[model samples]
Target: MSTDHQESVQELDVRDVDGEPFEQIMNALDSVGESEALRLVNSFEPVPLYDVLSKKGYQYDTEQVADEEWHVTIRPE
Candidate 1:
């Protein structure tokens, strides 16, 4: 419905993060428990990141913001 509602009840913003592998980010989120994990990435290559994170048991959603930047939301399983 609303962005905030969608983010709170359905998602969480991981915030802008850079210079980290998708696997590493997933691993870190895993340790945090089965909550929503968001990753703000500064990479144009979001497909691979999405694939990798999604494969790790996260319901992944991605949005491109600006140049070489994206916001990825992962709901952990």
Candidate 2:
């Protein structure tokens, strides 16, 4: 996506999740507006979240930033 598109997405960084991260992610997703997206940053690829979000009518793109880091952009389809 273009930098401008990315800039408008609602961002969520979960690399610092104290315990469970799923809840935090779900909350963010819930707050995403129809015209907005949720950008998730994590220390590792959040595989399970892909399925969960997909079932909720969200499409996602994952980019590996480092060996153990990933950036996932989720948007309503």
Query: How well does each candidate superpose onto the true structure, as a TM-score?
Result: 0.55, 0.85
Over 1-77, each residue of candidate 1 has an lDDT whose tens digit, in order, gives 23453333332233444454555665557555453455545456467666666566677667787776667766676
Question: Worst lDDT window (10 residues) for model 1?
Answer: 5-14
Cα lDDT tens digits, model 2, 22-76, are 9999999999988788999999988988888878899999999899889999988
Give candidate 1 misplaced runs (Cα > 4 Å).
Answer: 1-20
Error of 2 at 42 (Å): 0.4
The runs of at least 3 residues in candidate 2 whose Cα sits more than 4 Å from the true structure, single-residue gaps closed, are 1-7
Q: Against the hidden true structure, what lDDT does model 2 obtain?
A: 0.88
Local accuracy by lDDT, each model: 0.56, 0.88
Q: How accurate is candidate 1 locally (lDDT)?
A: 0.56
Model 1 clashes, total count: 1
